[model samples]
Structure formats: C-alpha cells, structure tokens
Target: MISQATIDTVFETARVEEVIGDFVHLKRAGSNFKGLSPFSDERSPSFMVSPAKGIWKDFSSGKGGNSVAFLMEHSHFTYPEAIRFLAKKYNIEIEETEQSDEDKLNTDVRESMYLVSEFAKKYFHDILLNSEEGKAIGLSYFKERGFTSDTIKKFSLGYSPETWDAFTKEALGKGYKMEFLESTGLTIAREDRPFDRFKSRVMFPIQSMSGRVLGFGGRILTNDKKSAKYLNSPESDIYHKSKVLYGIFQAKQSIAKLNNCFLVEGYTDVIQFNQAGIENVVASSGTALTPDQIRLINRLTKNITVLFDGDAAGLRASVRGIDLILEEGMNVKVCAFPDGEDPDSFARKTSYDDLVAYLDTNAKDFIQFKASLLMNDAKNDPVKKADLIRDMVTSISKIPDRIQREIYIQECSRIMDISEQVLTSTLAQLVQKDITEVGKKVKQDQKAFEVVKNESPVQGAKVDVLYRLERKIIEILLLYGNKTEEFEDVFLKTNEDGEIENVIERKEYKVYQRVYLSLQEDEVELANPLFRDIFNDLIQYFLQNENLEIEKYLMHLNSDFAQEVTDILMEDERVVLHNWEGQNIIPKTKSETIGQYVSETILTMRWYLVDKIIDELKNSVSNEPGSDNTESMSMAMDYYKLINSFSKKLGRVMSRYS
Candidate 1:
C-alpha cells in the first residue's frame, strides 16, 4: 500500500502538461494546451490539458481527469502503478507500507507480466554488456551495424546467450515466477523443463508510449536457413504487436515538437534515423500497417511521411498503407530512397542535413505518389488505365474530409486526363454503395428498447423527481461548494388563528456549510447511493480542510467514482470549448451565476420533498376507509401554499407536481 503523504507529494510535484507531454504532444491554446486526442482518431485537436486546474480532458472520447487519471487511462496502468510513474517522473520518493498476504494475492496478472518483461529487459541488457558470449557476439553484431554505445544504451539493447536455459535459470533464481515468464514469452515452458525464447539473438525492447517494457523483438545473428531472421514476443495481456509501434516512447516528444512522424519498417530503421539526429521516427516492426498503429501516431501528429526502401514490395506496402492513413483522416506523404537503399543504409550513408533535405524535397503527397506509381503499369492499355482510375477514386473516397476528397478528385481527374464529372460520379456511386451496406448492417443488428412492465407509475415518477433534484444538488455542491455567498433562508411560522406566515432571514455562509446544514436540518439524504456517498465525503473533507482541490480529491477516489466526477465536471467545459455559443446555442455558465444557481437548486429540492409528502398524503386519503383526514389535508395544503409562495419569490414555476 502507498502512504497518503507520498501520494499527496506525487500530486503536488507532477505537472499535468509535463506528464502528458511525454506521451502526447501538447501545443498552447489560450491558457491551456490542445493536442490530438490520444484516446481516439482525430485530425483537429480535441484533447486539452489545463495546468491551472491540474487536469486534462479528451473531448473526443469524453475522458478527463487529473495527471494520475490521465496516466491510468492512457497506459492502462493500475492506480499504484500510475502513482509510482508520476512519483518517479517528478523525482519524489515513495513511502510505502508493507503489503499483507492478501494484498500480495491480489496483484494483477497484467502487472505481473509487466514486471517480468521489465526484468527480462534488464537481464538481457546486462548480458550484452557484461557476459562473455554476449559481449563477443551480440555487442560485436551491434558494432558492425554502426550502432554507438550511447544508442545501444538509450534503446536498452540486449542479448540472450546461446545456452537453452541461461536466461530461464537466472530469472528463476531471482524469484520470478514461471507463469509470468511463460506468459510474457520469455521462457517456453515444456513438459519437463523450460528454456529461453530468444536464445543467441540480440534483443530490442519494445516499449509502450509510457516507456514500460511490453515485449521484445530479437534478431538472429546467424544465416542458418532453418531459423527465421527476426522473432517477436507472442501476444500477451500487456503487449499487442499490431497496436504498438517501435520507438514510440523515444520518438513521441520529437514527433509532437516537429508536428510530423516519419514511418519506417524495422527496429534498426528507427534507431538509425535517431542516430542521424532525426528523432521523430517510428517503425512498424516489419508488420503490415494497421489502423491501431496509425491512431497511435495520430495522437502525436496528423502528418505522417512514410519512408520506403527502393524495393518494389516495400513501395507496394506503402501504397496499401496510404488508404488506411486516409481512412483515419490523417495527411500522409511518401518518401523513397535511392535504388537499392533502405532507411538504415541510407541514413548511415547520408549526412544529417543532406538526409533531412532529401526527405523534404523528395516527399510526395500520397495522391500524387499513387497516381505516378499506377500510371507506369497502365501505360498504353485502356483497360488497365480504367482500372487505375477506379483504384485512385477508391483511395480518395477513404478520406473522411469532404473538401479533401473533392480536391483529390480534381487532382486525379487532371492526372488521368479524365473529366471531373466522370470521377465525381464514380466517387458518388462508391459512397452510396458504402452507405447502403452500412445501413443494411445497422438494420440487421439494431436492438429495441426493453421496457419494464412491472414498475408503478406514481412511484417511478416520485423517484425520478427526487433523483433529478438530488443530482442537481450534488452538482451544485461540487461546482460551488467552496464559495462564500449570501442566502435568503425562508422560515414559516403559524399565527394564533392557525394561518401561516413567512419569515425570511438573510445569512452569509459558505456553500458547503449551507448545503450541509440544510440537509441536516431537514433530515434529508440523497436518493442515489453514489451521489450520497460523494456528497458526504465532500462535506466532511470541506469541514476538515480550509481548501479543497478537486483534482487531488479525485486522486484518492476509486476508478468509477473518479470517472463519474470527471465526466460531470468536464461536460460544461467541453461544451464551451466546442463553441456552442458561437453557433447561437447558449449553455448555462455556472460560475458567473453560481450564487443564484445554488440557492435555487437547494430551494427546488426542498420544494420537491414537500410536494412528495403531499402526494403521499393525497394517495392515503383516496385509499383509506371512512376516517378524519381533515387535519392531514389541511397540513398538506398549507405546505403546498408555502412552497408555491417560495417558488414565486424565486421567480421559478413549480413544474414538478403540476
């Protein structure tokens, strides 16, 4: 268990922008920083980081919270893991209490896998630098590839010795469990014994965006025909190769800074470019390009320049990848090296300035690249030319932006010497076909709403009224609970003639004090259990502390409660940032009218409670036998009149019961 003091220290020391910037690139927008949503695929920036509030929000996905919440959401880190990550980043020392046996038993399997992967990374690295066979073979191979000592260390390059159980034996000796080792694919568990998975191979640790080791990709040094050249770790709970891009952890900062990412093909390609002083580069680790990987890069930048080797196969793969990038609404360019040269070789051969200049001058927009490449195959063949035109239109249609699609269509028409009407008509037909297919799927899969037939209408209505008012009260408390404001407290007294009179007293109190005291005086509690618990916590915490930090308070909450609070707090802010007002749609800005809002909400809740009691009384009179109900009716009528008068004074209609 982590101590409270340490958690507080982590929250205090960690900067929201700095922690998030390590993963997503954030640019200044007014007082906050705006960037592409790391949680979803988006071209225009929708993710926001507010340093003043110590929180961040991804408008696209509706996920928002403080620094700890961001880390947990983005990296899928456990609460403890996120706290530790922030603490380490801010250089704060963690004070932990000893875990009980039950706590040890409750450790998450995914976290265990992560621990094993991290341990393997260190073990392999140490073997490469310290062991005899590792130094002579793995280190030598890296040197031959022109990798510097610093580059090797920066990437955490390592080696697994040739002995079958070398790594497995050492890891076991250090008290690492076999289940985690097997799960991470570090050790292949056999019926009789286990062995290392990457024996005699030089290792490249594949890290997540937050720099945690997820898995490894090892390269075989020998030219044995029976063995594959490269082997990657099997997919586990922590590592999904299709969703991860190599070198993302190292390249994210530079990618955000430059507003572009250079996509390459292998681990060596990424390292070589970094060695050449180009830091904004990542590799697909030799897999076919995937939407998940593109979305990962989309978080940092919208512009992707794919670098291809002179090989025709690689160029073809680059062409196929262009459509995927377009589908995600990202701008893509293609850059190919000279004949027979790949990124790794080319980066080594060319100087830093020359390589960068070459890329800038040689990079072509995907539309142009696709047209030029296909034209060569369609030369002097009418049927082939028609096919080429159809292919270009298909790629163009993948673009989500209508203006971009129209522009590309115009360019394609000019290049292919076809009429604009012909290309536009073809594109329209394709789009309609797509829409029809999607409509069919939706119709087939759609579900009807299930209605509960057994619920009582009157009871349901009562609960709904109370739920809405209770929720509004909680919202008001969360937003304005710390503010000091004047409230008009209304008290009713009966005269000797049994007529009711109103007594209004003005009092100055903090919003928290007002809410707590009112609820206590009325012996009322919230209807929703979650809201009730949160409200109680808010009141108690306010009483104990002079100041309240919403973000810090959120850190101590469980995931569900934290998410609930974040959603409520960020909803209005998102609406404001989305420019709803500019569109002639005005939303209530709570801060400016908080005093009136709080008083009205509180009074409305009280009115609702009184109305509910009156309803129960009316129901009782209708269902009972002959009895003296005059006193009950008179009291109900008096309460109704008093609430109606209060509503009139507040300038609001009593809409609930009516």
Candidate 2:
C-alpha cells in the first residue's frame, strides 16, 4: 500500500491538465476543456474537464472523476498502478505503508520480474536496431517480412544475439540481479551455466494493458531442426499467457474506437494487420482461446471478428471456441483470407483499401458462418444434419440475450431450412439440461433473477431519491462544512392557548455542525454505503481535525471514493463551466446564504424519510393482528403531521426574502 502521506503529496502536486493532456487533446471550452471521449467514438466533443475543480466528466459515457480515475478507465490500470503513475509524473518519492512479510516479498518479486522484463525489452530492441549481428539477422528478418522500419519500432521488434549468456552477461554487468533475470525467463539459469532463452530469435515483447512488457515471443531465424521454430517466455509471476493477448497494448484504443476486434492466430498476423492500417487486431498465439483472453477484449469492446487461415480444417477447429465468446454475451463474426494465405501473408500483399473492403464484405456472423461451412456434408445425411442442428442450438443457448438468440435461430432456419419451433425446442432442452446439471446453484440464481424482475418502479425511484439525498449531504459537508454562519432553528411548541405554533430563533454554527446536529437530533443515518462512509469520515475530520483543506481532504481519500466525492463536488461546476460560464449564469452558490441552504437540504432529506416511514406504518397498521391498531395509526398521523411541518419549514427556508 502507498502511504497516505505520499498519496496526498502526489495528488496535490500532479496537475489534472498536465497528466490527462498527455493522452487527450483538450481544447478550451470556457472555463473548462473539452475533448472527444476516449472511451467511445464521437464526432463532437462530450468530454469536459474543469481545472478549477480538478475533475473531468465524459458525458458520452457517463464516466466522470478526478485524474486518477481517468487513467484507470482509459489505460485499464489498477489503483496502485494509477497512483504510482501520478507519483512518477510529479517526481514524488513513494513511501510504502507497513505490510506483512509475505505480502512484501510477493510485491517485491513481481516488481523485480517486471523490472527485468522491461530491461530486456529495451536491450533486445536496441540490439535489433543498433548492433551489427542484430541488424543483419533480426532487422533483416522483419524487413523481409514486409515490415516497415516504423512498424518494427512501433511494435518494439527486437533481436537477441545468437550466443549463450549474451543477454545474461550484459544484464549482470549492468547490475541487474540474476534472480530477476532468470525469473522473467530472459536468462535461463543452470547449475553450471546461464543462457539467454531467446538466443538468435526475432523478439516480440508481450505487454500488459498499460503497456508494461510482461514477457516475450521469440521466433528462430535459422533452420535448426532440433530447435523449436518459435518459443515463448516460461510462465512466471509476471506473465500468464492464457490471460493476455498479443498486440493489445497497440490495439486497445483502435478496438474501442471501432467497436470491434479482429483476433488472429500469430504475432506476424497482428503486426502485419496493424501495418496495413487496421490496428484493432490481436493474436491467440496458436493456443486454445481462453475465457480470460476474451475477457481482456471484453473490457474494450463487445464485438469480435475472429480472423483465420482459409483452410477449412483450421476454421472448423477454431469455430468451436467461438462459443466462449457467445457465452460471454459478446457478438462474434468470422473472417478468413483467400486460400493459401493467413492474415500476415494476405496483409503483406494487399493494399490497405483492398484489405479493409475484403474484411468488411467477407465477415459473417458466427452462426451463419458455422452453418454454411458444416451444412455441406450434412445435406445428404439426415442424422448428421440433426446433430448439426443440435450443435447450432447449443451455440444459440450460449447467447444470453433472448432476442439475439431468436434472431440467430431465424437466420439458421433460413440457411439450414430448419423450423424455428424445432430449433427453439432444442435450445430449451439444452438450457434445461444445463440447469439440471447446475442443480441448486442455478435455482438460487433463477430466484434472484425473479426478484429483480418483480421489483416495482416506485421502489426503484425511492432508492434513487434516497441516493441523491445522501449525495447532497456529502456535497454540503465537503463544500461548506468548516464555515461558521448564521442559522434559523424553528421549534414547534404548544402555546398557552393550546394551539400549535412555530418559534423561529437565530443562531451561529459551522455548516458541518448544523447538518450533523440536525441529523443527530432526528436519529437519521445515510442509507447509501459510499455516501455513508464519506459522511462518517467528514464528521471525524470537521469535529476533530483543525486544519481543513479540500485538496488535502480529497487527496487522502481512496481513489474510487475520491472520484465519487469529486463528482459530488463538481457536478454543478460541470454545467456552469460548459454551458453557462459567460452567459451571466448566476446559479446559487453555497458561499451565499450557506446556513439556509444547509438547513433546507437537510430538511428535504428528513421530510422524505419521514414520509417513507408514514407509508411503511400504513402498511404495518393495515396488516397483521389488530388490523386497526390505534397506536400505530397515531404514530402514522404524527409522522404525517411531521411531514407537513417539514413542508412549511422548507418553504420558509427556501424563500430568499424570508
């Protein structure tokens, strides 16, 4: 864990513009900056940033937050990765909090392995571009493969020298620890000797989503019969082959923008497609496609186009894994090149326009592609045809959307001449069989789903209302909590004549004090979990701590919570800065009449909760034993009267002249 003090320093020192400006092209839009959303394809700008508030909002995507949140969303970085990135950007020294011994060791080991991997990527890439042997062997191989110098450099293509311990000796000479070198599989350590794992091979660095080199795929240049044609880094703490895709680092942005992914089967396929100007492509690296890898793409886009060789046998084998994609509720299509060519060779030979047009025209939805390819031999064989239809229905059942499954079933009916009723019956049977196999677990899930399906809209609206009210409480505390101001407290007392009346008295209190004491008097607690957590933290800070700085307060919070707080603090500013900055838009500010604003907000919240309690009492009083309990009815009437009193108080507090 990063120490709180260090996190505070980093947040304070890192400028939101300077950090995000590196990734997004921000243009001046009144008091804020506007840009196209990085998360979606857009013609006009919907992404807004307010420098004054140190926050941003992507209107197109409904994602808004502080600087770290931007990095986390755009780059797929974890919380620690995002913080460390900001810390590095602002030149802040990191201070780690105390951890368990085991945790410390594990963290250190992964960091070390990552460091070694990064070092090896740079070293091999430098050798490929600069060294004599590397240029003659590795650079020549890439150039011969129709890769431009820019493409080679862009992908960080490299060459490991063809000698034992060549990379190991240099890494050690540079003070790189032997433990990390061997752990990352850059250097294989033996009892008698150490050797480079990728000697005499064209090196392709496999990077994490944030572009950190995790491992390598090395292709041998020579025809050494005993040596494997291609080798990969052995699995280690930092690299898990099943969970990552090649070229994801370079392809993520394009994949998101285009809303589709082209999954290929080799490193050269990815590289060549990117060079041919279609950058949203990756490779399975000849392994069976894993759910983890599909999920990696799922983070960016829901559409996948699996590119394959034209060989029918290869397509048949590969189409089986397309079910995993459908199981994830993703749309899938299959595209293959002409006979005797893969993505690499075809892309290497075709023009960019031709390559794109071919993909656009040849791409077929997975079901259509599967049925067409398999229906050939089954046309004359009735039993095989029945089995094929069942197989198609199985794939259809993997689709989570009922409408999509039905649409594909219709398409299959047209292609295979099978009736929709038959196909639908088959799918139901498969689904029921799955439920039977899952047994108790699925029954519980079905019950949960039914509960969700049965929830009323009014109940949902009440939850939304409560959510907004809780957010408002946090907004008040964060903005005006420490400021002392005049407040009017209304007391309802019975007069000497036994008539109800309101006595208004003026007093001075800090905003936090007024809100906290009011809630305390009413015995009210926030319902939403995040808002509740922030409320308690604000209470402790305002009541106990002396120094009150909003930036420091924001900096000390967890990033996820900080984004939520930043949203609450800046939601109004987003509108003010974007549309009303110079239009004489004099929206209400907490700084003016802060006391009444706080009182009204708190009263409004209490009024709703009181009203809710009255409704619940109505239910309780109308149900169960007595069915006409006077005491419950009296309590309900009292709450109803309280709501009326709250209504009058809110009206008085809200009227500016009062």
Candidate 3:
C-alpha cells in the first residue's frame, strides 16, 4: 500500500552493503566485500556484497538479489516489512492508499496477526510512557534496575495497568476486536468478558529481527508467594517460545562485529550485560534453548558463549541447550558465574574489564565443562563414567567440521581421563551410523524416483528434440535477445492452383527466421523456467507500450522476475568497464558486432540439426512407393547444400573468436 515514490526512495537508499552489513561481518574483497553466508554453515566466505551494483550474491546458496531480498532472507521479513524497514532506515515518509472494507476483511491472516501485534506493542508503549500508573510503576522499576531511559525506550518496555479492564477498554475503543486481542495474548477472555492479560506487570516487548513485536515478557512486581513471578505471551502465530530469542535485533550487529554472541537467561541479564559494555548479548528469557534459537544466533556469529548461573540446578538446566548449539556446528563455551552469583548480579558488581577478563580466563569448551561437571557424580562408578564419556563423544560428533570434532575429542579425552583412541573409535562408529543413515535416505530417494517414473511414460524422441531446441532458444534469449541486427528481405512468387500467387514482402534473417519458424512450425517455446515467464512478459510489454527502453523492460517485471532477469543479464563477465573514460565513446570495432557471431553460431547449429533429421527421413522413405533414384539423389544434394551454408555460417561465428 506504500506509494510508488516511497518504494523507489527505499530502493535507492537501501544499498546492499548497508543492509547485509547489519547482519554479516563483511571485509573488503577488492571492489566488493566478502562474508560467511548467513544461509548456510560454512567457515569460508562465500557471500559477496557489491556496493557498486547494489546487489549481493551468495555463491553457496545461489541466492542473489538487492537489499530488500537480504532482509527477506536473513531476517525473515515479509515484502512489506522489508520495504518498511528500508523506509525507516532511510527516513522515507510512507503514504498508503486506503483499502476498501472488503479488502481489509480479506487481508492475509498472518499479516493481520503481525498488524495486531504491532498495535499491541504501541498500546503498551503508550501506557508506560504516558499513563501515570505505568510511569510510576513500570518506568520506575526499570530505572531502578539500572536500565537507562534510552535502553528502556529502545526495547519498548512498558507497564500493564493493575485494573483488569484498562487495556481491553482502550483497545476496544480503538476498534480492535476482542478476538485479535485474545489471539495475540494481549487479553484473556472469559465467559462474555475480557481482561488485560498482563495487568500490573512490567512488560518486555519481544521483537523479531526486523523489529516487529512478536510477543512480550511481563514480570510481577508484588510479593505474592503463590503467584508465578514472571509470565510470557502464550505461543501465537508470531511468537514461538522455543524459536524466539530476546534482544537479537539490538545485539545482532554487535555480535557480527565481535564474531561472538553472549547467551544469557533473562531480560535483566541482557540489559545488565549491555549496561556493562558487552553489547553482543541476548537472553533466552529463561526458556529452554532450541535449535531454532541457536540457528538464529548462528546467522549472526558462529561462536557462542553461554553464561550460566553458578547454582548446580541452573547449570544442569542449561546443559541440554549446549548440545543443541553444538548440533548447529557452532563453537560454544560455558562461562559460569561465582558460586553465589548470577550474570545479572555479577555484571552489576564487577567492572566491565574485570568481568570480561574473568570470562576470558574461565570459559571452557562444552566437552571440558560437561566432563568436569559429571566427573564428581561419576566417581568410582565405571558404568556412570562410561555413560558420561559417551555423552561427551556424542556432543563432539554433532560438530560439522572434522578438524573441530577431532580437537573436541582430544579435549574430552584429556578432561575425562579417557583414552583418545577410545573417543576416536566412538566417533568412527557415529560416522558409520551417519553413512548408513545417508545410504538409507539415498535408497528411499531412488525408490521415490522409480515410483514417479512408473506413473508416467518416458518422452519420445520428437518430444526430446523439441525440448532441447526450446532450451537452446531460451539460452539465446537470455544471452543475446536484446542485440540488434540488419537482415535482407527476400520475396518470391509461387505457382498455386495453376495461377501465379504473390507472397507478402517481409524482411528476416537467420536469428529471427529461426526463432520465428520454430515457433510457427513446431509450436516450440523457450524452455528455461525463468526465461519462459520473462519472454511472455516481454511480448506483452511490447504490444501494450509504444515507448520502451531497457530500464522500462525491467520495470514491467515483478521484483522477483526483475531480479531473475538482472541476474541472468548481469552474470557474464562480458561488459568490462574499460579505461575509455578519457577517450571517445566509440571504438573502431563496435562492441555490438559481437551479436553477429552469436547469430552465425545459432544458424550453423540449426542447419546442422535440420540436415541430420532430413537425411534420416530421406533414408526412411527411399524404398517406399513413388520413390526414385533421382528423387533420392536430389534430397541428398539439398542436404549437401544446407551443410555448406551451415559451414560458411560456422566460419563467421569462429571468426569473432579468432
């Protein structure tokens, strides 16, 4: 619904490097920047950001696009959200066209949920900043907890008024439905009545990476021994507790810069660490860490440092999450606070330098930490010790890198007093198990292929030839469709029905004649999926629009199609920027002359195939009725003439290369 002008502004301002740099740590690689791909797990850099072209290409994933696409891919933002993010970043004012009532009613359900969540976030923020009770209660509490005003505002902390109906009444007054309120977990609906869900609790807005509010965490301030101290929004369309990590949006850039993420357990844990000058920290919000959450962190940084409270129960609760991190092939280190302290308390008491130094000194690899933690419990019990060792080896096996796995195996052996050879043997068994599993998967795939093949007949030779020709046509369209050429027109009269009939005069040459005749005679079409869609679009545009340019040609495409065309058109290293900056624009040899080479090659290939097919047809019919030696000889002679013409065309094509 954003105006076209605003969308254009966003596109112009959101440079690829500027957008991707927010999530990826890119270093200069000549004229571009290179970073590890966020789409895959790899140690080497394969994601290239080209500021010059305002595009990025992930060689590993084969995903290449502009800034908008990077946001969609890395942050999981929808198209509108990506545009809005860029608009906000570039300070573009958005003007939206009003939708009809029916259109509003038919809005996407997931997008509706997103809209409602954003509304609730604004409502809560208004309460905390403007309402007397919210300011006195929530705002004061956050300030007392050492959170600066800017930090509190940035995180969008708020207070839900103690009166049960306060928020429900306001939300209803604003025309928000009770159903949406309840669905978003902002209101609790009872029999014919609704109440604010987080009344009197201090609110923490949980944000997606694109800064949309997915859910909230609220803490009770009063001393009620029976009541739970903290409550989070129930799982909803946008908020999955296991997948959402707190403070990721704020800390993502810092994490990318530092190449490490500090994992903590609560909102205060995150705020306190940031207050203590460690900005690359996020909290799991006391929920058990899941692989989804770990992967989110992995997108920003490969190394994770998990901060655990010193209590044995706390450490035990966090141990399970470490293996999940390991399974993602992430480097994880465990850093426990002093026996009586938590991250929040420790960070508050210790200076930033001292806290950082202590963590640097005490951080232990998962294997070492797990081994040491279990060794006391396993003392003098062979069975317990063996189980502990197996658990350690299993964690080591989850690592993706072979060298890293071996290193962890060595550390596990040294810490547990187990033999390295035993650990290696255990790793071998795990690898063999993996290989067998993969083999089973391959066999399943083969069975699926057989089932599909059995359901349909294989294509005949004629269909196969048509497909190959179609593919070749698409290749030409992608590579040389825009190039212009001059052609000679030939007109002739033919005797039909004992009368001389004149055919219409027209001009055509090898390229257009071949393309036109193929479509006319065989009903063939471009075969490449992307190019086929584009070809149809190009025809439509040409028919409808009289004044057209190459830029306008791209404008006719949707962003997806435009991106595909841009990729195909720009992929070749054909157009090098020459040192002709100070020279005259024209060269003695025009660059467009290159198209003649392509035209010649295409004509040669077409003639060769046609001749081959003609020869086969002639041999088949030689002995049939009415066949004569003269007729057969004439067909052979025609084939030779076609072959000679093709050879001349082939020579012209090769001349360019020479």
Candidate 4:
C-alpha cells in the first residue's frame, strides 16, 4: 500500500497537462487544452483537459478523470501502478509496503507477463554490461556498429547467451513462474525440456508510452542458414506487433515537441537516428505499417517523414505506408538515401550536421516522390504512364481535405505534363466509387445485424429523461451547493375566506440544504446509482467544507463518477455561443440565476417521479377490473396535484387534471 503522503505528493507534483502531454500533443483551447482522443480514431479533437479543475474528458470515448485516471485508462495501469508512474515522472520518492512473493501469484495475467518481460530486459541488459560471454558477443556487435556506451545503455541493448536453457534456468531459480515465462515468449517450454527463446542474440526491449516493457526484439548474431536474422516476441496479451511501434516510448516526447515523426524500417535505423541527435524517430520493425501504429504517432503529431533505403523495390511498401498516413489526414514527406545506403549505415558514417542537412534537402512531398518513382519505370510508354496517373489519382483520393487534394493533383499534373482537368475528373470518379462502396458495405452490415437477440424490446431512451433530470439535480448541487440563495416555499392553507389556496414564502438557505430539504419533504432519491452516490457525497462535502476542494473530491471518484462530473461541468464548454450576442441572442448563464436553476432542476426531477408514480397507479387500477383501488387511486390523485405544483415551479404549462 502506498502511503497517503506519497500519493498526495505525486498528485501535487504531477501536473495533469504535463503527464498527459507526454503521450498526447495538446494545444491550447481557451483556458483548457484540446487534443485528438487517444481512446478512439478521430480527425477532429474531442479530448479536453482542464488544468484549473485538474481533470480531463474524452467526449469520443466518454472517459474522463484526472492525471492518474488518464494513465489507468490510456495505458491500462492499475491504481497503484498509476501512482507509481506519476511518482517516478515527478521525481517523488514513494513509501509503500512491498508485496510478498505470495501476493505476486494472484496478480492479473497481463501484469504477470509485464513483470516477466521487465525482468528479462533487466537480466539481458546486466549480462551485456557485466558477463564475459555477453561482452564478447553482444557488446562487441553493438560496438562494431559504432554505438557508444551511453547509446548502448540508453536503448537497453542486451545479450542472450548461446546456451538454450540458460535464461530459463535462472528465471526458474529466482522463483519466477514458467507460466508467465512461456506466455511472454521469454522461455519456450517443451515436454522434454524448457529452453530460452532467443539464444545467441542481441536484445532490444519494446516499451509502452509510459516506459513499461511490453516485449523484446532480438537480432541473431551468427549467420545461421536455417534461423531467421530477426525475431520478436510473439503476440501476447500485452504486446501486439501490429499495434506496437519500436522506440515509441523514447520518441513520443520528441515527436510531440518537434511536431513531426521520422518513420524508419528497422530497429538499428531508429537507434542510429537517435544517436545522430534526431530523437523523434520510430521503426515498424520490418512489419507492414498498420493503422493502429499510425494512430499512435497521430496522437503526437500530424506530420511524418518516411526515411527510405536506396532500394526502389523496398520503396513500394513504404509508398503503401504513405497512402495510409494520408488516409489518416496527416502531412507526409518522403526521403531516400543514396544508392547502397540505408538510414542506419548512412547515419553511422555521416556527421550529425551533414545528416540533418541531407534529410532537409532530400525530403520531397509524398505525392511528388510517388509519381516520380513510378514515372521512371513508365517513361516513354503512354499506356504505362496512363496507369501511373490513375494510381496517383487513387492515392490523391485518400486525402481527406479537398483543398489538399486539389493542390496535389495540380502538382501531379505539372509533373506528368498532363492536363489538370483530366486528373481532376479521374480523382472525382475514384472518390465517388469509394463512397458507393462504403454505402453498399453499410447496407450489408445492417443486414448481417438484422437478427434480434433481446428477450424484450427495451427502449433505453425511454428512461433517460428521468435519469437526465436526476443528473441535472446533482450537477446543480455540486456546482452551487455552498452558495446561499433565496427560494420560494409553497404551501397549501386556508385563507381569510376559509378556502384552500397556494401561499408562497421566500426563505434563504444554502443550495445543498435546499436540495436536501426538498427531497426529504417527499422522500426523493436520485434514480441513477452513480448520481445518487455523488449527490450524497457532494452534500456531505458542502456541509463539511466552506470552500470546494474539487481535486480532493476527484481523488476518491472512480472514472464513472468523474466522467459524470466532467460532462456536467464541461458541457457548457462544448456549447459554442459564437456571435449569438451580436445578434441579440444572449444566453443566460447558470451562475447568474443559479438559485432558480437549482430549483428548476429539483422541480423537474420531482415532476418526473410523480408522473411515473401516477402512471404506475393508473396501470394497477386498469389491470384489476374486479378489485377496487380506492386508496391507490386517491394516492395517484395527490401525486397528480403535486406534479401540477412542480410543473408550475419549473415553468412548464401542464393542464391540471384535478
């Protein structure tokens, strides 16, 4: 268990924007920060962070909370893990009770795999730095590649021994479970014997955005005829090759700061670029680029420059990657090294200044590079050139912006010496064809989901009205609970003529007190479980403290309650009242008439509850034709009158049935 002092220190030291910004590229939006939602694929930004309240909300995924909560949601860290991450990031020393070895066995499966992977990384790295065999083999290999000791340790380059079962024996001897070892692909278990997976190899640990080791990539040292040169950890619960990008954990901050990411092919290319003073670089690890991986970079930048080897044959796959980045609405540039040179080899030989200058001069717009590369093979052949134009048009259509597409098409027309009109026409046809295909796919998907599986036709929207009203009541109490306001008290009593008439008395009470007294008068409770808990807790907070400590309250709220609070607090931010005041359509802010707003919300909730009760009473009488329901009927009539009174308070025009 982490001590309260440590958790508080972490929370105080770790700024919400700083913690989230390490992974997300944030831009100022009014007083808050906005960025693309990390939880969902989106072009427009829907994620918001408010430093004043120390909370964040992702409208796309409906997940919202403070800094620690963001870590938990984005990286799937447990609460203690999140706190520890924050502590480490903020340089705060933590005090916590260490978990016994017995407690480790009951950990989550994914966590166990993560622990094993981390241990493997440490063990291999130690061997490389300390062991004679490792120094002679793995250390020598990295040294021959021109890597310094600092560079070697920065990437955590490690060595695995030649013996098949060396790592497995050590892991088992340390009381590590074989279940996690085999599951993480660190040790391959066979019926006869368990062996190390990467024998005679150099290790590169793959990490998540928060620097947690997810897996490893090992490069074989010896040129064995049968074995592959490079081997990666198999897809496990924590590591998916398609979703993981090599060096992302190291490159994220630099990419976000520079506003561009350098895309390379292999692990060495990334390390070499970083060693050359270019830190914003990552590799696909020789796998085809994936949308998921692109999105990981997308969260940090809107620009990517692909660094290609001199081989034109390999350029085809990188061209496909360019199309993917364009489809994601990002600006892409391509640069290729001279013949017989890749980023790794070139960066190793060239000075940092020369490498930077070369990259700047060689980088070309993606569309131009693609057309010129393809044009080389299609030269002097009208038939082949025409095919090239169509292919270029298809790539252009992947662009989401019309202005950008038009610009690229004009560039393509100039480069190909073709008419602008012809390229534009071809582009339009391809775009229309894509739309038609999408429509057909949507219809097909609808047909596939035609089968109904529910036992009853329950309309979720039917109950939302009351739930919203209850939620609104909580919102009002939370925002204005400590504020004292004048409220009109209604009473039905005899007048001078001895006739029952409505009498109104105005009284001063705190917003929380009024809500509590009103609800207590008729026994009303919030319908939504989350809203109910928040409402009671918020009332208690207002009662105990004069000043609202929103951050303190947030410390105890689960993501669900925090989401509700953020939706309530930040909903007004989403409402754009742009230029409405100029047109004499000024909106009334709740702060100005908060008392009235609170009363109206409470009245609306009461009215909804009374109406539901009246309906239930009516249904009961209607279902029993032979029995008399005089008591229930009288109770429903009273409820109807109460509804009328509440409707009047809420300024709703409902005809009185009584």
TM for every model, in the order presented, reads 0.89, 0.71, 0.81, 0.85
Ranking by lDDT: 1, 4, 2, 3
Candidate 1 total steric clashes = 0
lDDT for model 1: 0.87
lDDT by residue (tens digit), candidate 4, 1-658: 6889998888777788989999999987656788889998788888888887787888888888888889999999988889989998878999977788886656778877887888899999999989999999999999999999989888888999999898999998887899999999999989999999999899999998889998899999887979889999998889899988999989999999999999999999999999999999999999999999999999999999999999988887678888889999989999999889999999999999999899999999987898878989898999999999888888899999999999999999989899999999999999999889999999888776664524446666538787778777877876788889999888899989999998889999998899999899978777788888998888888878896656667887776777788778766645321334556666677999988888887777667667777877888785555787898999988987777767766777974321
Q: Please provide, for model 1 over 410-486, each residue's C-alpha lDDT reduced to its tens digit, 9 standing for 90 to 100.
A: 99988889999999999999888888999887766653212332343436566777777777777777777888988
Could you tell which candidate, 1 or 3, scores higher by TM-score? 1
The better candidate by lDDT, 1 or 2, is 1
> Top model by lDDT, which number?
1
Better of 2 and 3 by TM-score: 3
Error of 1 at 122 (Å): 1.5
Show pairs that collide, candidate 1: none
Residue-level lDDT for 243 in candidate 1: 95
Error of 3 at 78 (Å): 4.5
Q: Per-residue alpha-carbon lDDT of model 2 for 1-658, expressed as tens digits?
A: 8988887787788777667665565667766787666676454577777887677787778787777778878765666778888887778999998788887566656666777888899999999999999999899889999899999989999999988888999999987889889889888879999999999999999997667788999999888999999899989887899988999889977886688999999999999999999999999888899988887787667789999899989988899889999987788999977789999999999999999999999999887888878889698999999888888889999988889988998998888887889888888898888768889887898999889878944355677778888898999888788888898877889999999998989999988889889989989889888898999999999878765665567657886777688677767655643466367775666677777878878888887787788777767765566466898889988877777777787665322110
Candidate order by decreasing TM-score: 1, 4, 3, 2
Error of 4 at 248 (Å): 0.7
When summed lDDT is taken over every stretch of 10 residues in candidate 4, the lowest stretch is 573-582
Compared with the true structure, all predictions reach lDDT values of 0.87, 0.83, 0.76, 0.86
Question: Which is the winner by TM-score between candidate 1 and candidate 2?
Answer: 1
Clashes of 3: 0
